[model samples]
Target: MTTWWLMRGDVRVGELRQYGVDQPTFLCHFVSGPGWEAVRELFEAWAAVQGPDPDGSRNAEAIRPLMDLGLTLHPSDGGSPLTCFKGCILRIYGDRARLRY
Candidate 1:
């Protein structure tokens, strides 16, 4: 299991926790912080996609938090990628952090 720091500058808001060969889980569990709202939005949007109709069917895309603002899809061992918003400042961690472009 690998846990990467989802950081915005020096402040750590959330985490992308990978558990074995399966898909990693987005741990957006935050209390109070500067970027806490963004993490909360992500957590809410992602939480809605949980569970399934036996075959794993879900509703609309969980990209609502990244609506008007920009988006970055970082790389991980998880099959379904995780979303982390670092405000307007865009910083790429090589191939690990990409703009989905």
Candidate 2:
């Protein structure tokens, strides 16, 4: 599975799977940092549900935990047959971090 490096500028907060739930080897560091805690919770929720955006289907519940954390998907994904599956939220949060830090 593809992995996305969740970074805060030069620093890597963690890596998340590109699709499906992360494996046992998933890594989450800097728990107290910007994206770490939220990302951890998102991953746990995804793992418990098997995966997010399953079979290219929009998994609303999979991302519910991140709603308050500022996760947003492209509106195209809101309709039947998503534009792309497992769309990353890192960009949104990363930008937020950039502004704050």
Candidate 3:
């Protein structure tokens, strides 16, 4: 039971530009702030769906939220059971945070 939630709007990473860079890079954002409970829920759900990867199952709940957040994956890359999320800002100007399981 992987639960997914997409971002409805552009995410804001505070304090950037000072370093002088371009676009921001992020895999995901938690608008409600970093709540460990949420992370745990997401992680558990993802793991459940992943099960034994040998079966080659896709976790819809986990992936849906990611897609809703506007996080686009490179065409060259395929999705995996491992969930990796990042709270990031412009390379040179913004800040960064990571959420992985």
Candidate 4:
């Protein structure tokens, strides 16, 4: 299974946020499975619109819109699809960490 993280602060600052949910609580919410395909689609669209690597050479700013979209997609759930997917992408791409305010 893929793991996710929630990072605090912005691309300017590399601060990481603690996982807000405990494992049991996180597991409960996450068991339902988030729409990763939708998340990928949104991220690709955002990246295309934002252009490549606005902040760093890695273009962390492109992920900002995905974080915003997560707020809409995952509503009351404490587990964030944006954060999760961002972590996934970072790992997949083997790129630098990306964070958004």
RMSD of each: 10.0, 12.0, 12.6, 11.8
Clash pairs, model 1 backbone: none
Ten-residue stretch with the least lDDT total in model 4: 9-18
Q: How does residue 44 of candidate 3 score in lDDT? A: 48
**Residue-wise C-alpha lDDT for candidate 3, range 56-96, written one tens digit per residue:** 44665464554344331121133342212443211111123
After superposition, the stretches of candidate 1 with alpha carbons farther than 4 Å from their true spots are 23-34, 49-61, 67-101
Tens digits of per-residue lDDT, candidate 4, 1-101, equal 22333233321111122234343232211221234443445445544544445456345555565556433222233465454444333221112223222
Worst 10 residues of 1 by lDDT: 92-101
Candidate number with the higher TM-score (2 or 3): 2
| lDDT (Cα) of model 3 | 0.32
lDDT, candidate 1, 1-101, per-residue tens:
44444444556544434333322322222223455455555545545565664543343355444433433333445444334443322222212222211
**Alpha-carbon deviation at 52 in model 1, angstroms:** 9.2
Which lDDT value does model 2 have at 101?
9
The lDDT ranking, best first, is 1, 2, 4, 3
Our model 4 lands, by Cα RMSD against the true structure, at 11.8
lDDT of 2 by residue, 1-101 (tens): 33344444444444433333334332222123355654665645544554445474444666565544543222222333211124433322322211010
Candidate 3 weakest ten by summed lDDT: 88-97
Model 4 segments more than 4 A misplaced: 1-34, 44-61, 71-101
